[model samples]
Target: MNTTYRKVIDRITAQTLALTEKNREKLSACLERFEWAKNDLLLREGQVCKYIWFVDQGMIRLFYNKRGKDLTEHFAYEGGIFLSLESFFRQIPSRLIIEALEPTVVYGLGYEKLHGLMETEPEIEHFYCKILENCLILSQQKADACRFETAGERYHRLLQEHPEVVKRAPLIHIASHLGMSPETLSRVRAGLL
Candidate 1:
């Protein structure tokens, strides 16, 4: 990891300073990169998720299928974290589906290896705990935003928070993340401009 990622690691864990040099070395060694094409299903519903991913580039969505409709629950872009959380955590089938929105490169760690690392490295454990906490917070925020925010408000907030995504992702994927139809998102954007 570079100084930048080291800083990210530190920010993710308040008690990270106690991690031994050997533990840090292990973390570096476990990091591995994988790539997938647009529309690739990284983990399908009812499948066991194998890896917890950190996005380096491109985009992914976590969604669930219900009555033949896809309900988008989360989106991960560059510098974001992603995984089928329930499957990754509980070692069971996941209801959520993880798919790439564009060609993506992700740094991934297997569940077993991550658990072992967490047991041996307090910092790694704390880091994961923080990750889970942040994920929960974000999930709640997304739910609230979609339920209560106007389309324009949601779009503007997204532009402010993830400007890079506005440039990199297709408009339809952004629409899905915003909990709007593509046409509705277009109208909202036009109205804002």
Candidate 2:
């Protein structure tokens, strides 16, 4: 196994659910590695998401087109797992697009393989369930931030919690994720400085 892939597997096993050595071996066999250039689309709107991607290097962004504007939903950097969850689980077309923000390497677990693993191993199912729960928590946090926090406060919170995003993501994409205009984000950043 690649060292990065092994680290990812070990990290998940530690943080999510424990997998037996046999299960881990099975999972390692199922995972596929992929590399994408910056701006390459991993999942496009109206396409079914077939894989859950674990980022081993670089970054990806989840976004959607809304009334001719791009609204960024999330960013996943190294050591993060991402997918169009609704589409992946429901086998429906995705409403969002996932794109590589930089030259990226990811380990992808195909849906069919994941399903088979979950069917055979309860531990895998539990691990997936925990991942979904974390996704829901993140969704709720974003909603709450948009609804209750001022733009400045949200930006501040983002800086504190995800400084990598502030440092690595484009300002326009960061503004979109924070529900602010680019100019507003620039002003907020200037004020902070």
Clashes (N, CA, C under 3 Å) per candidate: 0, 0
lDDT of 2 by residue, 150-181 (tens): 88999999999988899999999999999999
Which one wins on lDDT?
2
Residue pairs with colliding backbones in model 2 are none
User: For model 2, what is the error of residue 110's alpha carbon versus the real structure, in angstroms, after optimal superposition?
Assistant: 1.1
Error of 1 at 22 (Å): 2.9
lDDT of 1: 0.78
Which stretch of 10 consecutive residues in model 1 shows the poorest summed lDDT? 8-17
| Model 2 lDDT, residue 148, Cα | 99
> What does each candidate score in C-alpha RMSD?
3.4, 1.7
Tell me the tens digit of each residue's lDDT in model 1 across 103-177: 987877678888998886777887678777777788888889989999999999989998877887778778878
Q: Pick the candidate with the highest TM-score.
A: 2
